[model samples]
Target: MADGQDLMERIGRLRPAVRAAGQPLHRPLLLLWAIAQAVHGRPRQQPWSVVKHELAPLLTQFDGAQRGERDVVYPFWALQRDGLWEVADSAELPLTSGGRRPTFAILEQVNPLAGLPEADYNRLIDDSTVAADALSTLLVRFFGANSGSVVEALRLREFVRGPIGASLLPLVGEQYADRKKIAEAYGGNGVMGITPLADGILAVYSDDKGPYPDHHIPETGWIAYTGDGLSGDQTLTVGNKSMQEYQKQEKALRYWHKPYNGSWTFETWAVVIQCRRRWGRGEDKKQRREYVWVLAPVPSPLRETWPSDVVEALAQDDKSVHDDSVDVIPAEVVAGQESRKLSAQERYQQLSDAARRTDGNRTNRSKPTLVERYMRSAAAREAVIIRSEGRCENPACGGHPLERTDSGQPLLEVDHVNGLARTGQDTPEFMIALCPNCHALKTRGAGRGELQKSLVPVARKLHRAMQRGERRKARPDGT
Candidate 1:
């Protein structure tokens, strides 16, 4: 048997050699999920049902939709080869790609048999330092696919430097208290008798290899968001493309994506899973491989179809709501006349307090400033909407936002012209109004990036014209 030092080193060296396109996040995600459970007094060996419930959404969140939900089962069973984890199964392991097959009869509360060896498992639970070291190793190894080195990205925490203790673990604290809420939401008996995702929310298409509805990906299927999570007679009520039409389109479902200079498009949310990219046949070895589309509601669909109250509660935490469009109320940093230097302890405490107070407009020093930001976003939205005149600003594809919203207005969303998360200010001059389709097209791929760059000229022209019109309105003082 590998010693603890040997095992830890192996865990740190794990990589996504499994697939070409995607870095497999299964083992790392499972480790994080299991660690969180163990830290919270739940056993390290979680039930299959509980594991599925908690880990599937996280897998979708961390891993791109390229892999299926069954992928979650792999690390649970296969980690024995690596020495960090072991699965206690009754039967011989199955040989399918994703993982061991699960029986549908699952009791959510029942704990299944699985974990590290007894000594290792006990050490993990008894000594928080060991757990933190393990978590750091997993995070740094798996998330190496991210923009920068995980060490650099996570350096603010001591564990990222080297594990100080469980206290220094980034994912362990209340910053992730919202993980439970999200997990429970995913775990609940999801909407039945129809597909679960909203109409426009695109996902990687499945190989269509499996039985009827049992596509290997969990919560995987496109349930057109009719209303109340029921299929509107399985009609194309949400977006321009209906399921029937999509089925008939000779283009493989992989190619059935939004944007791409196509006549019609579908929108999807992805970490890097930006608007779906279909697999292609190049020459030999059968061109490209396809992803199994999972049938769970990503954040966008959850916002639209699930109960508003539920979404609000989930989104209440700043870190919880994963949607880019969801507004988070950032605390206004009130600059004191003479700032006193904080002690190291004070600095940590201050940061801790700030992390917890994510709710809107706390009545503290600058109680009223959040409204100013609210006004800016609101005003920018209205101006962009009016400027677009309810038509898509992208002259090439002037599609409406699917159907009109209930407010009797064209369904248009305000998007930052220069990119919101990057450098763009959320003001009228920097924002553009787009129908959902155009928005998707504008956001994905190198070709689309060029398109966005070209539209900058168009957006500047609109801004100049608007400025001119405003001067006309204020002609008395136009000089």
Candidate 2:
């Protein structure tokens, strides 16, 4: 029997060789070698429990040995656990069958050869490695072909090179196959299956292969074909010939058509709506109603079926309830913006004078003075106050106020509880922000009765909340 020292030496030598045999053989070979020795010359095939039971005791004895921990050793032990090998089954032994008892001699037969022919086996391994790498590269390139133009180019090259090139190219002809497999595996739109044309090109013919609908091709641009290849007596122009043709051919075709007075032209339609809002006296003395004038475009098909009321409204100068009109205006003239009857400067001057008088003739009542000098500065401060309040304070209005407008700045005037002109307190608490329509109604003495009753209680609650927050800050630990 080999001594324990001799067995240890043998195992140490085998470890390096097993590891050098590549990733696949590393653990399996180590476990196989260990199991072979433990079962050497045994007639009874031991169960995994028996093998593990035998090996477990040695772990403590070999604890401080040169080898590592249980993780390194458990893999070898697991081989028996998993049924890769068996303890010597006496019934299968030739000697037990009346010939000769199978001894340690069979161990050599079962174990991998210590001196495996390196060249022959290594060549097979190397070829497999190269094939795997090639397949990966081919798959990457095939997936990268996202466009029809790219697919067509690949097809052309494959056709020119013929069978030999196709075999060499990673996924030359199997573009659709790779795409479909990848899509299915990853759960996306399946590969686009395009038909190969005679000119060594591929064209998308249908949407059957994809998960989604195919691109729409207008009837005018769609071409029909009768043959398997591009060449045929019956052919339809699926694409604009000029757009598809080579640059050289494109210029040549243009020159040929020039003498025939054939030219490409473009046209567009304009749909305009003219709306005007007018208020007039009603039959009831105290009631006034607003009238709306609407002019809308009518499509060519609906021209004959146009509503008579709409047409008559547009024809008359008076305001109408509804109107629709269709008139042909030259495309070039319609393309430009319509001319304004009044200039901006004239409107600005008129608005400035009106605003000055509305501001109660405040000192320095110029246009820019009223706006940039006072109103803009006040609007900025009001925006800050609105943000601070978090919402509209008016009890009648519960909506959050997210915006403040310069146009509504006149209505957002700082209103003092005792009147700004009288109290002179410009503090945020003294002033309340209100929307333009709401502010107008308040000034006209419409909603003040409700607002005055609500504001007092809201101010008292807010003041108490501030006092409670101050008290909490003053005393870090409650006494």
- Give all TM-scores, in the order shown: 0.29, 0.17
Clashes of 1: 10
The 10-residue segment of model 1 with minimum total lDDT is: 224-233
lDDT tens digits, residue span 385-446, model 1: 55555666665664554347653466777777778546424455566777787888888745
RMSD of each: 22.8, 33.5
Task: Give the number of the best model, judged by TM-score.
Answer: 1
After best superposition, candidate 2 residue 131: deviation in angstroms?
A: 99
Off by over 4 Å in 2: 1-390, 398-414, 456-479
Reference-based TM-score, model 2: 0.17
Q: Which lDDT values do the candidates have, in the order given?
A: 0.41, 0.28
Model 2: per-residue Cα lDDT over 333-378, one tens digit each: 2234347532323322233233333344445433222222232223
User: Candidate 2, residue 469: CA error in Å?
Assistant: 6.3
Count of backbone clashes, every candidate in sequence: 10, 5
